[model samples]
Target: MALSEITTRLTAAAQAHGRDASGITLIAVSKVQPAERVEAVLTEGHRVFGENRVQEAQGRWPAFQEQFGGIDLHLIGPLQSNKVRQAVEMFSAIHTVDRPKLAKKLADLAQERGTCPDLFIQVNTGEEPQKAGCLPSEADGFISDALAMDLPIKGLMCIPPIEEEPTLHFALLAKIARRNGLEGLSMGMSSDFEKAIAQGATHIRVGSAIFGERVPG
Candidate 1:
């Protein structure tokens, strides 16, 4: 499908979910997509994007910024504790903060540099052992730990298991966010974004639907 058609579908889905299209931000996942495609979306006036790898985001963001002035880049995948400093520097927001070690590293980096990007704790909503998020039961403690630092804790994020119904996962994240006083829920993607919007997803990461299948890396 074309980019314009994708945008229209996204808008329609937002509307069908009883959500104002403006309320939710569609962060085009630009992981393996080339800069030209990203530029195409920018030409369509998409200012926010999500990327899975910090290195990938770092490599592409500079040119995108040069051309687009300042696009909002979100780190939407597992963030290694070792790369916290660079991750803190490159992206506008980090959505995969899953452990206290990484959190502390981000906090320390922020203290040294006097800045840290918006932070979102990634929760293992699906309890997938292979995933890179903290389990749901430990959310409050982790959020509290991150909050104690001077860095801003904006909200929570999760990637539900691909095979399951997303509403259950979205609802779980929403519940945790509410309990922790978090306002942002970065859930949903190409397939279940409307369901996400209905459940109060502030940020939706869309890839295949927006950019089409990625060019193989």
Candidate 2:
């Protein structure tokens, strides 16, 4: 689908929930996509983008940002401690911060480098053993620890189990954010973004619906 079509649908979805569309950020998940496809979206004037890998973004975004100013890049994947500095420098937001060690690393880097992207603690709302997030039960303590360390945490993010109803997970994430005094909820994807919006998602990551299927390597 075209970017306009996606935006229209997103706006309608927000309106349907009695929420203002302008308050919702649409992050185009550009992971694994070629730079040409990214450029095409940039050409369409969509500025916010989500990338899952630091290396892939480092390989392409420097030039893309040089050519197309005002773009916001979000790192929406698991981050390693070793890459904290680079991720802090490159992304406008880091949405998968799920542990104390990584959160402390980001805080130290922010102090040293004087740049800190918005942070979102990823919660494994469904308690999936394989997922990259803190368990739902640990979210409050983790958010407190991040705040004590001066990490610029702004919200909570979660990837619901594909087999479960996503609305339940989205609601859980929103609740976690609220209990911890967070305002941003980075839940939702191409499959059920409208439901996410209804559940108070401030940012929705959509990829395939707008860019089509990923080309298998």
The C-alpha lDDT values of all candidates are 0.87, 0.92
Backbone clash tally (model 1): 0
- Please list all clashing residue pairs in model 1, or write none if there are none: none
Lowest summed lDDT across 10 adjacent residues in model 1 is found at 1-10
Taking all chains together, the TM-score of candidate 2 against the true structure is: 0.98
TM per candidate: 0.93, 0.98
Least well predicted 10-residue stretch by lDDT in candidate 2: 208-217
Candidate 2: where are CA atoms >4 Å away? none
Tell me the deviation in Å of residue 65 in model 2: 0.6
Q: In model 1, what is the error at residue 77, expressed in angstroms?
A: 1.3
Residue-wise lDDT of candidate 2 within 2-37, one digit each (tens)?
Answer: 789889989999999999999999999999876778
lDDT of 2 at 90: 93
Over 4 Å off, model 1 = none
Clashes of each: 0, 0
